[model samples]
Target: MKLLILDLDETLIHATDCYLDRDPDFEVGPYAVYKRPGLDLFLSKVRSQFHLAVWTSSTRLYAAPVVENIFPHDVDLKFVWSRERCTMRFDPEHHDYEWAKNLDKLKRRGYKLEHVLMLDDTPAKLARHYGNLVRVKPFLGNLADRELFQLSDYLPTLAETPNVRRIEKRFWRKASTSEP
Candidate 1:
């Protein structure tokens, strides 16, 4: 199976330590995270198709509960990674984050360079690995969101593709083409 590395916080779930509501789907210390709609079904379909792993930018302490709540016990996820496993670079322009997910780290772990795909919302996170990154629109507490299924619809064909490197980024997101 091809490798599919996922990102949290606005990708799989919406989380914020800055806000609090009466009730939340998940409570991770001071952070409140909500499940993205269709996440379960999306994971179900993808689990069968890819060697699934979560590589969120969030720290282990914060991302742990969120992962458990969203993925639960039945999800056959292969691995869960956090900021510790990622590489950090200082961006003078953006002071918010100290690091970005380094896809090369996984490449070194024997995941084929041409056979891996990273589903992330922020472009900067995948800046060094642009070609292999599929830009999924960030999800933020949208229970009606269908982004997961939209991706699921495209994955079967993606899994069947013999050369992942040849697959253009257009097929990765919202662009469409009409050609015979």
Candidate 2:
């Protein structure tokens, strides 16, 4: 099965220290964590088609509890990696250090880059492997957001592609729909 690495913060859920107008689905320490709409259905539908894992830049202290609450107990993730697992790089454009999730790290663990897909909101974090990335719009506690619902329909289409990297996924939203 292909490995699908999911991002945590704005990609899947929005964790804010300040409360939004609506109550959060769950809380993580002082953060009000809101699950992206259709998150549960997305996970459920994709679980059988792909091997799932989480690769968040957040610390284990923050990521663990959030993962525990969001993912169902029956759905076993291949791994839940935290900040320590990310590669730190100095971004000259931003003039600051950023954590990047390198797919080479997965190659070291016996996974093929062609069989891996990363779902993340930040393109810069996966700049080294744009081929493997399926970018999503950042979710910010929008009650009516529907990205995940659309994503659930799009992802399975790539499940059997010989090399997922070869497919143009930057416009996956459009590719998934009949829209031009």
Candidate 3:
């Protein structure tokens, strides 16, 4: 199955410069609002063809509000996941090793690596893990950025190409062989 995995912070929601009033009593991930142009159209198109899921580093308590604001009520909430599934690191200098946790989740769910498409701004997270991810730079602009535009450009091509199916099969084949 085709799965679309998205990052929440910079990918879906653009953070404002102001600091959110943190509830000292309640410590959680930072609160941020989203900004994007034609986001509704983009989301609608995505919902049409793909099984949508969120693979964000944000904690569930923090990510839930933002997701509800962005997605329609009818969208399945079961697909939303949080940092609990992410990889964590203690080294201060090392970047958070959290993004690829969703990849594991997807694999456990029987999704082939190629059939899974991750849209993330940070290449560092995906560079070492999955090859099928479409890396996009973070943008706070009013319109869809170049990476998203490129994805749009490729959708039609992907739809018409039989090679994509072959690629998915190959990925599954490799996965089965690797399994004990």
CA shift at 135, candidate 2, in angstroms?
0.2
Best candidate, TM-score-wise?
A: 2
Please, what are the lDDT tens digits per residue for candidate 2 over residues 1-180? 999999999999999999999899999889999999999989999999999999999999999999999899998899999999989987777888889888899998999999999999988788589999999999998878888988888999999999999999987888776334
Superior candidate under TM-score, 1 versus 3: 1
Clashing pairs counted in every model: 0, 0, 0
Per-residue CA lDDT of candidate 3, range 1-180, in tens? 366787876676566544344312122245345445455666777776666788787678877777777888887644888887776543333644444453655678777765666777765555445465555557664343533434444443343333343444212322232222
Please give the lDDT score at residue 20 for candidate 3: 42
Q: Any idea how many clashes model 1 has?
A: 0
Q: Provide the TM-score for each candidate, comma-separated.
A: 0.85, 0.96, 0.69
lDDT tens digits, residue span 125-151, model 1: 875677777887888676668777777
